[model samples]
Structure formats: C-alpha cells, structure tokens
Target: MKPQRIFITGGASGLGYSLALICAKGGWRVCIADRDIERGEAVLGSLQKIQPQTIFMPCDVTQFDDLNAAATKLQEIWGGVDVVVNNAGVAQVGSISDTPLSDWQWIMDINLMGVVRGCKVFTPLFQQQGHGHFINVASMAGLLDVPNMSAYNASKAAVVSLSETLQNELKPHNIAVTVVCPSFFRTNLGQGMRSTITGMQSKLDKLMAGSKLNAADIARQIMRALDKKKSHVLPHRQGRIAWYAKRWLPRTWYQRLIHSQKK
Candidate 1:
C-alpha cells in the first residue's frame, strides 16, 4: 500500500512541526508548508532524514493563490492527499475596543480565512479522490469565549464553526473533518503574538510554559482523533471540563465561573 500523503501549514515549529514529524515517522509523505523559508528548510532537513520524500513548501495561508497553487502542485506530485492540516494561526490579546481594526483583520486573515482557503481549495480535490481528512487547529478560547482576547477567540471560534459545517456537509462524500480545541501548552505561539497589554507576551509565555501538555502531547492526541474520525477534539482535560461546565452550567453561574479566574 502507498503511504498516506499529508500537507501541514505552519509546519516549521510548534504543533505543526510535531504533527509533521509524527506523520513522517509513520511513513507518510509530508509537506511542510510555512512562510518562514529558513525555518521551513531547517525542518525540511530533519524530515528528509526520516522520510526522504518529505518536501518543504513556502506557503502563506493568507494568500488564496498560494494555497490554490499548493493544492495543485501537491495533486500533481502525490496524485491525492490523504490529509490537510490547517494548523497555521496566530495569537492576539486585547480588549475589543483597544485592538485596532487592522489587528483584527490581520489575525482573521491568517487564522480564520486561512483555514477557509485550505478547505475551499482542497474540498474539490477530496471529492474527486473520494477520501480526505481535515484537521483544523482551534483553541479553548474559542470554545469558552475567554476574556481579553476578542479577535483571537473570534477567529478560532469561526474555525470551529466552519469545521462543524464541513463535518456534516462532507459526511456523505467520504471526507472527515476534525476540529481540535486545545488549551495552552508549551509552544512558541507567544513569539508572534499581538498584544496591547504591557507584559502580556511574557505572561503568555509563562502561562504556556506552565502547562503540562506540550505541543507533542497535543499533536499525538490530534493524530489519535484523526485515526478515530472524531468530529470534535479537546486535547486537554481541563479544556474538556470547562467546555462541559459552560454547556451544563447556568448562564449567570458560568459567567461567575468565567470571571473567577482573574478575580
């Protein structure tokens, strides 16, 4: 049997890197796509050692033509892709009023529309092949509607919504969609974060460093969910508990619970 072919955006570092490494080790033909050419090639070196056919693609998800061309190129090379991980995203923290309109558009373009473009470009390819899987990386902020990160939350929330829509819309077509909503873990996400808070970046770094589940742990959980064809995945226990609480708890009570974190 031929190895499964997988394409991952933002695959140079963080969860994307972990996912690519895992898939490559499992004998998949991996395409590591990111805008950072230096980092992408660095990761390419490692992946090539594991799976020589692994290729690095310089992809900026915000560009529709880039994504479309990537889909086209991969189709020609591999014949068909088994999975597309729309894992490229960024973090931003600020009150809605404090955040500039430009910042909102920036995050949404990369985080939300990036995933949309991936799906749009690949859905037809998947349909033609009769099988494909999409792994969309979201965040717990999207599910819980956390405070102080309006744009980031909204973008991820939109991804969750779109993933759900695709889950049902593509069910009969033999394509599977899984949205991963994970709380913070150790990652370089803070490095590119946009924030108005004076020390929020350092705080984010600290918060992520404190988490027990790192990117590799989350990546493994995602792979497991994909193998099982789960529609929704919350990789952390606390995230799952909070999601259930928000769903079952009363509105005022949940609001209090949400507020209690900072209080």
Candidate 2:
C-alpha cells in the first residue's frame, strides 16, 4: 500500500513542524507548506531524514492563489492528500477597544480565512477521493474568552465554528473534521504575536516557557485523536476544564469566575 499523504501549512516551525515530524516518522508522505522558504527547506531536510518522501512547498495561507497552487501541485504528484492541517495562524494581544483595525484584519486574514481557504481548495479533491481529514488548530481562548486577546480569540472562535459546521456538512462525503483547542504550549507562536498591552508579550512568553506541555507532545496527542476520529480535541487539562465549564456553567457565573482572576 502507498503511504498516506499529509499536508500541513506553517509546517516550518512550532506545532505544525512538530506534526509534520510525527507524521513523517509514522511513514506518511508529508508535504510542508510555508511562506518562509528557508525555514521550510530546513524542516524538509529534517523530515527527509525520518521519511524520504517528504517535500516542502511554498504556501502563504492568507492567499487563495498560494493555497490553490499548492493543492494543485499535490494533486498532480500524489493524486490526493489524506490529511490537511490548517495550522497557520498569527496572534495579537489587546482588548477589542485597544486593538487597531489593521491588527484585527491581519489576524483574521491569516488565522480564520487561512483555514477557510485551505478547506475551500482541498475539499473538492478530498470529496473526489472519498476520504480525508482536516485538523484546524484553535485555542482554549476560543472556547473561553480571555482578556487582552480579543483578536486571537475571535479568529480561533471562527475556526472552531467553521470546523463544527464542516464536520456536520462533510460527514456524508467521508471527510472528517477535528478542531484542536490547545492551551499554551512551548512553541514559537508567541514570537510573532503583536501586542498593544505593555509587557503582555513577555508575560505570554514566560507562561509558555513554564508550560508542562510541548509541541511534540501535543502533536502526538493530535495523531491519536485523528486515529480515533474525535470531533474535538483539547490537549491540555486546563483547556478541557475550561471547555466543560463554558458548556455547563451559567454565562454570568463563568464571566464572574474569569474576570475575578484578572490581575
């Protein structure tokens, strides 16, 4: 049997890179797509050591043409992709009132529309193939709103909503969708986060540095969830707790609890 093919956006670094490594090690033919050709090639080299069938393609998730071109190339070479992880995203730290309109646009373009573009470009091919999986990386902030992360939260929430709807709509077509809501883990995601709040980026960096979970560990768990066909995955204990709380608790109570903890 031919090895299954997995395509990951933003696979040059962070969680996407970790997922690419895990999939390649599992004998999957991995295609990593990123706008950063240098970093993408570096990661491709590493993935090639684990699985020789790995390749890196230049893809900017915010551009439909870039995503479409990458998908077209994959179809030409591999017929169809077995899995597509729409994991490229940008973060911003600021309240809705404080965040600039440009910042909101930037985050939305890359985080929410990026996923939309990926799905739009790949769904047809996956439908033709009769089976495929989409893993959209959201965040715990999407489930439970946090202060100073309005833009990031909104973008991720849109992803969660999109994934849920897609899961229902694509079930009959044999395409599976999983929305991954992970808490802060050790990753380079924070490196590019723009913030209006003073010291907010440093605080986030410190918190991530102290996190018990790492990107590789989260990648392993995501692979397990994929095998199980889970519709939603919260890879951290805190995320799971927040998810249940938001679902079961009263809106006022949850708000109070969250706000009371604000420093």
Candidate 3:
C-alpha cells in the first residue's frame, strides 16, 4: 500500500502548518504550499525529516495558475493525492460602510476564490484517482455573521456555501468534503489582518490570546472529524454554542448582537 498524500495551502503557518505535521506523522506524504518561499522551505525541511518524500511548493492562492501548476506537478510525480486542503485566507474587520471594495476583493480572492480554484484544479485529478477528500477551512464568523466582520465573514461564508454545494455535487464521484469552522485560537492570523476600525486588531488579538485551544489543538480535532468523514467540524466548544444559538435563536441572537441600536 502506498502512502496517502495531503496538500495544504497556506501550509507554512497557522492551522495549515499544524495540520501538515499531523498528516505527516500519520504516515502520509505531505505537500506544504504557500507563497512565502522562505517559510515554506523551512517547513519543508522539518517535514522531510518526518516523511522524506514530503515536499514544498510555492503556491499563491490568489492566482489560479499557481495552484494549477502545483496540482499538475504533484499528479505527475506522486501518481495521485488523497486530500487537498484549501486553507489559505486572510482576515479583515470593519462594518460594511467602512470596508472598501478593495478589502472585499482581497478577502474574496484569497479566501473564497482560492478555495474555488483548488476545487476546480484538483477535481479532475481526484476523478482520475477514483477517490479524494477536500478539507475547506472556513470560520465561525461565516457561520455566526458576527458584527463588524463584513468582509471576513462574507468571504468565509462563501467558502462554507461552496463546500456545501460541492459536498452534494461531488458525492457521486467518490469524493468527500469537510468544512472546518473553528473560532479564533492562538495563531499567526492576526499578523496579516486588515482593519479600518481602531483597536479592532488589538481586540481580536486579545480574544485569540485568550483562547484555550491553539492551532495544534484545533488541528487534532479536525483530524478526528475527518477520520469519521464528517461533513463539517466545529472544534471549539464555545464556537458550537454560538452556532447553535444563531441556529435556534436567530431573533434573540440578532437582537443581542447584531440588531442596530441608536448610538
């Protein structure tokens, strides 16, 4: 039996980095893709120690050609891949009025369309191989529609929606889909965040710093969910509580958090 292979975007840092190690340690070959060549190669060196066949490919999720070429090269060299992770994304926070169109485009391009491009470029290879899995990393903001996260929320919401559509459309092809929606946990995500609101980044950094779970912990839970082939994973317990609140108490949830009040 050959070793299964997993390819991850933004694989040099944050959740992507953690998940790469988990896959490698599970005896699977790993491909860590990111635009950061320096960081990507560093991670590749670490992974090579675990699985010598593991690799690093510089992939910028915002560009279709990057993912296309990377996927093509992987297929030609590795025979096929068992999993693809569309986890490259950026965070931005602002009310709709404050978030410029460019912010929306930036987030949508890297966060949502990046995942779309991954699915588009990989489906054929997966079809040729007879089986595959897609792990789309979304967010709790997408599920919760949290206030002041217009761009980030909408971008991730689009990912969640795309994953759902793919889950049904790709089922007949023997492909599985999993959407991960975890709330903030300690990671480097804040370093790249864009914000128009004063102190917004500071506030978010504090929340992330306060989280009991870190990227590795979230990665472990995501792996457990993937083991069961679950369609979605909400790894944070508080995230689950908020999700249910929005689902079962939409009116109350909105009034408490989102309902506009005169300032």
State which candidate, 2 or 3, has the greater TM-score.
2
Which wins on TM-score, candidate 1 or candidate 2? 1
Task: List clashing residue pairs in candidate 2.
Answer: none
Number of the predicted model whose TM-score against the real structure is largest: 1
Angstrom error of the Cα, residue 245, model 1: value is: 1.0
lDDT per residue as tens, model 3, 1-263? 23478999999999999999988887888999999999998888888888788899999998899999998899888888889999998899888898899989998999999999999999999999899999999999889877788889988999999999999999999999999998988888888899998987878888898888899998988788777889999888988986777788857755585554213
Off by over 4 Å in 2: 1-3
Give, for candidate 3, the lowest lDDT window spanning 10 residues.
Answer: 254-263
Model 3 earns a TM-score of 0.95
Candidate 3 or 1, higher TM-score: 1
Off by over 4 Å in 1: none
lDDT per prediction?
0.92, 0.90, 0.88
- Name the TM-score of candidate 2: 0.96
Tens-digit lDDT track of model 1 for 224-260 = 8888899988888988988999999998888898899
